[model samples]
Target: MSVSIIKCNSYRECRAGIDKALSLIGGIEKFVHPGDKVVIKPNLVSKKRPDSAVTTNERFVHEVIKITEAAGGVVTIAESPGGPYSAVLLKSLYRTCGMERAAEGTAAALNYDTGFTEVSYHTGHTLKSMPIIDPVLEADVIINLPKLKTHAMTSYTGAVKNLFGVIPGTHKAELHFRLNDRAAFCSMLVDLCERVKPTLNIMDAIIGMEGDGPTSGMDRHIGLVLASASPYELDLAASAVIGYAPNEVPTVREAIKRGYSPKDAAKLDVMGESIEKVRIPDFVKPESHFNLLKLIDLPPALNALVVEKLASRPKIEYDKCVSCGECARCCPPEAISMASGRPVIDKSKCIRCFCCQELCPKSAVRIKRSLLNRFMVNFLK
Candidate 1:
């Protein structure tokens, strides 16, 4: 339950910096044993280059692979992205980040489909068992290499959120539709994390996205690399460094309640530098209300009605939208249509999963709140 925070000033020194950070928390050998099949899960959500800050840096992935090799473990890079999960996109992302050449020269194999093996989870609720992607379930160890970035849906996307890549691309939209509420989504994220428990968690924060992130956000220089054995602990440290509270992030709060180490920062022995040393300026929370139920308690049906009416997808600026159709393609429940010039969201059918907001390439879509909604949010804060 220890987290290590390091102030990494440049990607040029990422390999050495990350090595030092991992050394503080029992080192790579402690996690990846000899002859183990280590899966390096970097944030390859899209084909965007490293400079875009949309995906984990190639150099960071290479560094982790180097460490795994040094530990006598076989390394393989893998991920499942939304909207037509293709090996081509994954390979392209790696090449953009300068990983393709390294993979070939290092003789590291890349597993795309590794196909799928169905594993069941007994939830003890309406869902008796759910099938998860196979590569994650079969790997001897997983080194979660996630980029530090803001998420329009869950507030911040860190280690735990990055594990969502294991859910497989085709099934992700369905899961979003099923777990519509923020609390429910948080629960599902923790569930997935528990199922595919990574041996190590690493955050690539040398350059991170903010404002409207995960996909379409501006990059800011935040020179640091974070490592932890516990994903929850890593997320807690990440939230703090980003000027957010553990409770403010639904996934972190839920992980803590589920007996994960989100709080108890004192129990976490930070390694390279104090969090205050690498702390970034306060990041603005996306324009959305978090604690909706706290404002008023309504019956289940009434609450559903109110939330549905209140939550509407803000209009997409066609000029700004690059006709990528990513929003239309990823909309859960198939509520977005691009039959017109650009994508048009059907509010009545929309489930408000925020998949479009997270995947939009142009940063055209945002959560628009009316004057009353803004007033209520301000008053509540």
Candidate 2:
């Protein structure tokens, strides 16, 4: 399998970069045929603007839509962002993320249907059956448009993690509650990617997030656009660009273990700029993931004990908190509750999924690592 890694410095260069990337991988026509129902899934994780690099760049997605439409495919932009999925939320997200402007003069339509249907994936290692968004279920072809970012829970967010948006509203939290183990959660992500199997994978890396992300992070210009037929390979290449080894990302590690991707990214057929040329060696990873727990080869039970102390936990920034109760409402394990207009977290019940941190609108939730863990991490480095 081949992945196209075109160097695109700005959103204005998206059309050309995306077109070239598509051509390098045998063109949009290879996946999109006339009259096909195409669903373009972009990561609108929150109500963040495109410049923040929290969500997929609208200009980048616009180019994908135009190319697919030019090939006579009916294009629709669909996404189930974190929190309760509804038409109102979707509308607000579309407007805030600049998707409305992207589709201003185009034939592409935005999906407002919050309805979902049950899908059975017998081959899934962690999940057997689940609900998927209606637009994705009805599509003849799925085109994944994901934003490259570091994640608090999953380490890296790209091709495979992006498909988590298809599971409808709060069902994502349900899965997080069920499979609290990091490996199992990531395995479920691989299963979701395998089930949906997007015909094309495109990533927005022109300006991506670093440090604690998917939502709260600093925007770093990586100046690259990536595309691939294989979601696993796409993630493998994208994660490597940002200084992550394949095994560092849970989803990529799972993919490699499942034989879906090459363990060594150097073995893949990479077109356009070399990974070495564009690689950011100093990319800041999520501080929440800086601990050395994963590197220690302890028994399962002991490992969990050590991780409980070392792993990062969510902390509410009371000064910045607006008492919105959003964190309480979205917590997977019901570990958070709003008491007297302030949300309090039940650490005993907390599963460390970071849904509160991820879905918090005010960025009031922060990852807090213990003093001992911090010292160990720094000393190891």
Candidate 3:
């Protein structure tokens, strides 16, 4: 397993960077055959524009579409973003995320199909069976186009995490409710990757999000494009480039435990620019993801208790909130409810999945850690 990395300073340099990154591994022809049904799964996590670093850059996606189509592969851009997966929502998301413009001159078609098929995966540790989007289920080749970003719930979001989009619409909230434990949720992600089995993985890291992300965060320029056939290995390298220990991200740690990827990303075969050359020494991580309990060797029961009390919870910013009820609608455990045009949380039922923070359109949700957790974080540092 090898990962190819190429320096890409801007979207304008996307085509060359993508081409070279693919070439380093093998080539576009290696994965795409003539008359192949290619599904380009870009990370349109929400309706945010590409410049926000919330989704895959459209220029980067467009170049992949062009290259795939040139190789005699039929291309379709597909993604089940953060809300109800309806034709209307899909149309708005595509237009906002620049998918419409990206597919303007190319033969790539934007997917509006909300249909899904349940596939059985007995091998999955956490997920035995799940509904996958139709386009992905019917594809001959799945080109994973993911953006490198920090996630409040998962810490790092990359190739493997991108596959979470395969689960259609509100079922994602159900899964989140079922797998409230971070380890279980991450293990499910690995299982999803195994089930999807992407043909190739390409990551856009020219501008990546830091601090609270996958949506709300500041953009930091990293200027690199990365690719790998193994989604696990691709995430291993991409997460490390942004200053995370391989084990720091739960998904990468799960992959390591499963023997899907090396325990250390440094052990992987990396081409083009070395990790040290592109590594950001001070990339900000999500505060909510930091747990000091890992350092203490408490009994299982006590550990779980402390982690629950100390874990970060979502707080609604009343000033920033538009009272849109988005947070209440997306809450996995139904812990949130709209009262007098404002959201009220039932702390007893809260699961800390941060779905409200993730799917909130107004960016009104914030991660709030307990006072003891804050002290522990600073003390540990």
Query: Which predicted model would earn the best TM-score?
Result: 3
- The TM-scores, one per candidate, come to 0.91, 0.98, 0.98
Which ranges of candidate 3 are over 4 A from the true structure? none
Give the candidates in order of lDDT, highest first: 3, 2, 1
Name the better of 2 and 3 by lDDT.
3
Error of 2 at 90 (Å): 1.2
Model with the higher TM-score, candidate 1 or 3: 3
What tens digits encode model 2's per-residue C-alpha lDDT throughout 256-278?
A: 99999898789889999988888
Candidate 1 shows a clash count of 0
lDDT of 3 by residue, 127-231 (tens): 999999999999999999999999999999999999999999999999999999888999999999999999999999989899899788889998999999999
| Model 1 lowest lDDT segment of ten | 123-132
lDDT of 2 at 124: 88
lDDT of 3: 0.91
For model 1 the local lDDT of residue 31 reads: 95
Local lDDT at 301 for model 1: 83
Cα deviation at 218, candidate 1, in Å, is 1.7
Higher-lDDT candidate of 1 and 3: 3
The CA lDDT at 291 in model 1 is 53
